[model samples]
Target: MVNLVVTLRKKSQGIWRSSFVRSVAVVASGTAGAQAVTIAFAPLITRLYGPEAYGVQGAFISIMSVAAPIGALAYPISVVLPRRDEEALGLLRLSAYISFFIAALIAVGLWLGGEAVISLLEIESISTLIYLLPVAVLFAAWKQMAERWLIRKKAFGVIARSALANSGFLNSARALAGFVYPSGAVLIVLATVAEVLHALLMLIGIRKRTTIDLSESSEVSTSNVIELAHRHRDFPLYRAPQNTINAASKSLPVLMLATFFGPSTAGFYMLSQMVMGMPSTLVGKAVSDVFYPRITEAAHNGENLSRHILRATGSLAAIGIVPFAIVIFFGPWMFSLVFGEEWSMAGEYARWLALFFFFNFINKPSNAAVPVLGIQRGLLFYEILSTGGKVVGFLLGFYWLNSDIWAVAIFSVVGVIAYSGVMLWVYLCAVRWDRDKKAV
Candidate 1:
């Protein structure tokens, strides 16, 4: 019995030490630490800023999220696929230039019609801070580019440390600012600063470790960059639209709740999302970040991917279900306990959102697999359909049921359905690809 126990222990250790598991651990640990900081500071921050301020910040973040994904036309996302460091470097530079141009375009648009757009969204509270959106977008785009390059280098440790540092700085600044001036404007400004800091940290981290001699490399010339852009046009044409629509779908509730119900309501929703999203952010994103390069490599090598996809999905489901269940059952009480009574409503929102987030959590593998499957065009249409469903569900609750909880509940249900469909479709696609590859 003693020998058997020892053997089993060794086996478990070996499994844990596997590359995939180790990579996940590195990224997840950093993310977990970051989330811990955010969680630790939440009570104090919420008390200082209150819901209305959070609502204003949430609205600004929503708009930023919708625009930031496409700021570089999704070129950074393709950075991991290139075989050569020079080519990847070229792609990186191209993405940066495009991001700058997009940022300038955003600035121009804001200069021309910023107030009207703010009025239309009913987010005039953030009117003064809205002009900073372009700068924030640029920072967000740069951060993504830097992170993607780190991912390509398999520098998961650096990526993880940067995430921890970014979260630490952002949350600390927010808490500190709240004590001095707990306005939405302050929150927005600090949030933008956090983006800039994160980008710089990631870039600096890579610069120290990377052996690529960009100064000597003439391969990243104008013509070469254009050629790389053309080669990866599918990202801009398909993935960009897909990502934008997907972001809009997720962010729509924040905007709609603010516009229809009130900013305070949106604030509640935002808090719920932030809290409920912890599991996904901690594990799902780590898994996706590590899994993407592996899946891409497997695809290039004609290896089977369905097994990987299924295994990751199953593992995430097993890990997530219990915590999500806890939220579903005791979310309101937990929120009230942690954030005080004013946040109990946010807990109510979290109860329903837990279901959506569970499916979203399990779908990370599929999300990572979609781009690898060369199905970006199809995915774009699917995103549109999914967004439409979310809109219809939200409107149905608002116009027919006339209850905020019902609206959130319906929106979450639609999200659950949409993400489930994506997982199923991606799994089937992987199976077909594997079968065809074997036949060939």
Candidate 2:
């Protein structure tokens, strides 16, 4: 009996190790490909679009950000932990339908609320918001859901290739539009169209890979969705609050900058975010793409889930933090040189935000592990406190002192650190609980 147990343990360990390798290979390749396409286009986008265009894009990005969770309606979380083929397809269809409906509503809302959105962003015109519907928000949501679905299916190659193709199309369209239209307004419109084109391509790629047959199976009903929601009830229950806090915390400062500092200063800040976000988002997202699915698979046994989570946290931290430090030191000058002299101030903003991004990079993957381990309530509590802290910081910076740009910068750095600290504590506590439970 002892000999048999030893052999079984060895086999289990080997299987886990293999799964780790496969997960890393797939996620890394996809993330690296995405980073490549986005990074390669950075110079051209900056040169052609300019800072004001970037500021507008950033504002639009904030509004469109709501589209993802709204359209997905918790489907990303569902995809990460589907227990059966039927469950996976059900969630997939529900997510698509939810996304389409929400996108249409949002597009129409944007059309009606164009003036309000433009005024809120402090831009001079609503023209950009008017066209933001079909080209930008809807397509952007489609692309995100498609990407999440691809991750669920473990189709990394499809993701990589589509990212490249999408980037190529977007840049090419922007270039042509700039040459012919000359107005920034037209270029923004064209970019939205490009995003739709990108989504269409990803959809084609997804269809080829997954065997999702809705016709043969019984239709997923309202009760089915509600049941699915109840099945993974912890997702939006825990994730939604955390996501809302994090999203609001991140966006609030940018919104304040736009409100007080004007679009040009906001433009500079936007550039900084775009630069620092690449690494943070890339590493965190890649690890998450693997971590959620794997941890979910292992969750029935606490010991297995804990080991996987810790292993992932370590790998993600090591890879994510080192480059973050290097970027912090060299980031300002790199920004100036890369983005041109007009964007020199962006370098200053970059330096501060880099620290925030680094902390975020270090902590985000670990936070992602919580939901998979069934400890999302802890994360929710942390985000609640962190969001309160962020709001206080924002008020102190913007309202009390009336320091515009610097206030925004300081708030970002401090808010991220505070948020990361809480997240770390929660993750560690969850890890300890798993260990103790395993001992029992």
Indicate the worst ten consecutive residues by lDDT in candidate 1.
210-219
Question: Per-residue alpha-carbon lDDT of model 2 for 1-440, expressed as tens digits?
Answer: 99999999998788668965667566666666667766776766677767776776666565555444455555566666666666766666666676678777777777777787677777665455455654465566577667777777777667666766766666666666665654446545666676787788778987787766657336767688668867776766777566756777777666767777777777788888877888765667666766666666566455455455556667666776777677667766787778777887787777777778877766655676666656678777877777777677767877788876567566766767785676567567667767777688
Per TM-score, the best of the predicted structures is 1
Off by over 4 Å in 1: 1-7
- The runs of at least 3 residues in candidate 2 whose Cα sits more than 4 Å from the true structure, single-residue gaps closed, are 1-18, 126-128, 181-187, 216-222, 436-440
User: Candidate 1: lDDT over CA atoms?
Assistant: 0.92
| Model 1, position 303: C-alpha lDDT score | 85
Q: After superposition, how far is residue 405 of candidate 2 from its true place, in Å?
A: 4.3
